[model samples]
Target: MNNEAANILLVDDEPNILKSLGRVLKNYSVTTANSGPEGLAHALTTRFDIVVSDYRMPEMDGIMFLEKFMAIQPEAIRIIVTGYADLEAAQNAINTLGVFRFINKPWNNLEIINAVEKGLELKRILQENKALADQIRQQQARLNEQDAILKALEAEEPGITKVNWAPDGSIILDESDIDDDFKF
Candidate 1:
């Protein structure tokens, strides 16, 4: 999806962080939630392409919130922004939770915007992959059904489904040999 059409969610206890991030990402549709529960509520009601959360919060930490958020919207790209940056938090966000980006608390405006754009691109790629996979599955199912039909036809009439190709690469059909029920 394009930036203008993509929906982004920002969850942080600080109003300033939310506002600043919202302002920087004004090109896209942005939703802000003050708490983990509030973020989850928004996740239930809306479909967001990306989610950005703060690591430290009163009730639920960013890791916990993002874990629950993933359950709600598995496709949404996740990000954790924290002032208290630690190796453990970064590793957990990346290795376990599949958080796309870990932004420092004193994040550069351009860096944050770049991260959002990259996250959006990842979402688009994933969505396209899913669509292609679905199409491939549907095509495979159709091929299987056709194979079954051909097999049944062959059982009823031996070599009926076999091709009779001429030297000119044209299909040769014997109209008199084919029954009315076999006509295509």
Candidate 2:
């Protein structure tokens, strides 16, 4: 989906942070929450394409909130924006929680917008890969069913499933392979 169509959720205890995030992502379908609880509530009903949250909310930190949120909507891309830039927090957000981005507070508008756009691009690619994998699974199932049918046919009439075509495209059956009672 395009940026305009993508749904984004901004969660922070500070209203100013939420406002700034929302303003930066104005082109997208944006929703703001004052706390993690409210964000979770929104997640329960609406599916967001991306979630940008502050790391130090009162109800729950961004990691905790995102952990629960991921359980609810694993497909939504997760991003943490925090003024508190610590290596441990960044590692946990990226490594443990699978956050897509760790954007710092006092973020430049272009940087935030770029991060969101990249997150949307990642989401789109993942969705496409999932769809392709599903299609391949379905095709493999069909091939398996056809193989079973072929095996059954071979059991009933030996060599019936093997067709030897000559250069002229005519069936060339060996005398030994042809069943005694079989007709052309």
TM-score of each prediction: 0.91, 0.94
User: Which one wins on lDDT?
Assistant: 1
Question: Tens-digit lDDT track for model 2 on 136-165?
Answer: 999999999999999999999987888999
Q: What TM-score, to 2 decimals, does candidate 1 have? A: 0.91
> What shift in Å separates residue 38 of candidate 2 from its native position after superposition?
0.3
Which 10-residue window in model 2 sums to the lowest lDDT?
175-184
Q: How accurate is candidate 1 locally (lDDT)?
A: 0.94
Candidate 1: clashing pairs of residues: none
The deviation in Å at residue 121 for candidate 1 is: 0.6
List where candidate 1 sits over 4 angstroms from the true fold: 170-184
lDDT of 1 at 19: 98
Please state every model's RMSD to the true fold in angstroms.
4.0, 2.0
Most TM-score-accurate candidate? 2
